[model samples]
Target: MGIRNKLDISAYFVVGPENTKGRPVAPIIRDAVDAGFTCVQIRSKTASARQLIELTGQASEVIAKTGKSDIVTLLVNDRLDVVLAAKKQGIKVDGIHVGQTDIPVDVCREYLGPDAVVGLSARTHELFEYIKNADVSLIDYFGAGPVHETTTKPDSGLDVDGKRITRSIEEITTLSRLSSIPVVVGGGVKLADIPSLARTGVAGFFVVSAISEADDPGHEAANLVKTWNSHKR
Candidate 1:
């Protein structure tokens, strides 16, 4: 099966820098996986291509040691080159995620190949509609949110037109109904908000500070996953 098909995308999703709370990438990832996260996105706003690729290599090693490589998916944020470089180094990078100003979805799919799990971030239903109508197959899923305001990525829901669009529960519900692929909500998602967000019918939640800034990522991840699973439709 392809990486997209192999993934349980609805489970907890984690994104981070090279270090989480001063800990290295590999150990944090291992803890997250052990605690039940199914996806990890390596996001470095300032790292060079070489640095990102090295991080992927290190993270891949840690993931391999767990022997759950088949189950977990590792994606790089907005760096197609890093994904390709990691592959050249024999790191099993599953995919790439692009935003509105990054590489277009079709080009990303072309570079990464058909089996790779390409994701797009969408803050508005209009953008989501464009993706759905244009070429749904080119993308695997949508990262939909800033369900609440966030400091994690301070500019998360800003559009190309320079307007901020925070997706309401009703808006999320509408988008979920319209799209055939899974929609995972992120941004300012707290444990207490899971039950309410789950009721909107999204497939999963993406978390940054909720896990990365936690006292124990594994314990926090476990709690988030438990909350999500418990409130399923």
Candidate 2:
């Protein structure tokens, strides 16, 4: 795999929050993309593998029609089968995210190859220690933080909102300084809070509720993009 085949997939994503909260998701995704989100991660918990495949297929069409660049769709857990299924359909998915219990990075890469990205979730300081000690050959980017007590994933660490961002920022800053890859901060990253997080030198974020539940997803997405852009620079 080479750089030419790889995608620079770093952006705000509105994923699954609408349907998870009993609201429609398609319109929200459409609005979010219209609002200026270049990429949106398609993540849905509680759905079976079959259901997820169908959902990703539908989402693939919507995103393809919009002409956004980095459509880095990811599976929540380390489900290589699902990722392969989605990729087999020629979908624009560029990455797959794995949790603590998911398969290790080497196996995922062997199945998906070196080109497709693999995102590892790291929440606690102890987990950060492990990531720091592990061989950097397997991983690509780090998805750090629930950054808050979110109803989305109950098992997540740190119940305090915004504070997780601080911890994730501190960790990712240190990790980024040491590693060649980037670190992405996920969980409870509100549109209003992106600026603070960007200042922490996080590579990007994985957001669901903020864009999925915003009053105006389009404007909310525009705000998220504009804010992150200004802050990152």
Candidate 3:
């Protein structure tokens, strides 16, 4: 509850060794945070636990160096074990972001304690049902969408029919209005989508390759932040 009340999710950057194109992840994290990304999720599908722990440590160091560590939040994607290991090692990771199939939200909240921020992912078809059935008090926010198709997370937002679902601005707006938890949209999100997405009254928008694979990560991150700020409610 502590971090959730003050969480600034305006520009959330999701990055990892896989997201960066043969580039060092720490520098990219540094650039994104320096450029105004308020939250970061360390996600990877290939790295081992020890490697993730090391990378999380490196990312924490860079965020701290930016001098905005107090305002910026760092989280691990789908890995409560990594979050625990990182914290045990003295790295300042803020919380965990789990997918529908990942560790359960209550387990995450129980393990991380009341202060930790726990995020859950949901697709459009299930969005309403989830809101009605889920213990909303256990989750701090919802991560929804693939505004467009993306290779970074190829199967994101796939519906029960197994078809890729691109959430429309209208659907997003409605979800934001209906849910009590903050919602952050991502998956193939581009610079052009920021203004409209921000105006949808979502807590924020997140990106993967948009910044991680950009020619100038910092400049791109800054522009995303600026676009969001210009239209955010």
Candidate 4:
């Protein structure tokens, strides 16, 4: 199946490193899949290309072995080359997630073709407006946040004036309603915040430290998924 078709964008989303606070990527992915997270983005910023490919390959194996390969979509953050490299090595990575400074979304679509999942980060209204005019056919989803201050991504959060630079709930709601693609919110999203975030009507939530730093990633993921699911009920 195509990545676009396979992805349940409304489900829980998880982003992390190969070794998150001593937790390995493979088991974390397994736990995520079992806990009903439908999307995983491998964001190993400091790892080399070979290391990323190897790590993603392991994650792909876990997804495949657990029989969630068709349902779960795995993406490599800002590394289209790694995604292509992994494919050549027989690892099934779904696509790439890019920031404004990364490759243009259209270029990514041209390289990966229509079926590849392309996610772009929209932290400001201006960025969201730009995304609104973007070619929806080439994009899968929009990742909007650091809903609160976050340490997961060193570059995330507010600017010099102490303003919340990321999209607010009102902005998210407007974007969710206006855009054709799904919108997933991220950054500093904890279990206690899920209920309120869910009310914003985003397709889903993106998590990192909340799960990666937990002593039990599986349980943490399960709780997150459960909370997300409850909102739909």
TM-score for each model = 0.92, 0.82, 0.96, 0.91
Question: Candidate 4 has which clashing residue pairs, if any?
Answer: none
Give per-residue CA lDDT, model 4, range 196-220, as digits (tens).
7788778888888777777888899
lDDT of each residue in 1-233, candidate 3, tens digit only: 35667888778999989888999999999999998899999999999999999999998999889887678889999999999999999999899999878888889999999888888896556877886577788888899888899999988878889987888999889888888888889889999999899999999999999999999999999999998998887
- As a whole number from 0 to 100, the lDDT of residue 231 in candidate 1 is 90
Top lDDT: which candidate number?
A: 3
Instruction: Output the lDDT of residue 148, model 1.
Output: 78
The residue pairs that clash in candidate 3, if any, are none
TM-score of 1: 0.92
TM-score of the candidate numbered 2?
Answer: 0.82
Model 1, runs deviating above 4 Å: 123-125, 160-163
- In model 1, the worst 10-residue window by lDDT is 10-19
How should the candidates be ordered by lDDT, best one leading?
A: 3, 1, 4, 2
- Model 2 misplacement above 4 A: 1-6, 17-20, 69-77, 158-172
Each model's C-alpha lDDT? 0.80, 0.65, 0.89, 0.80
Clashing pairs in 1: none
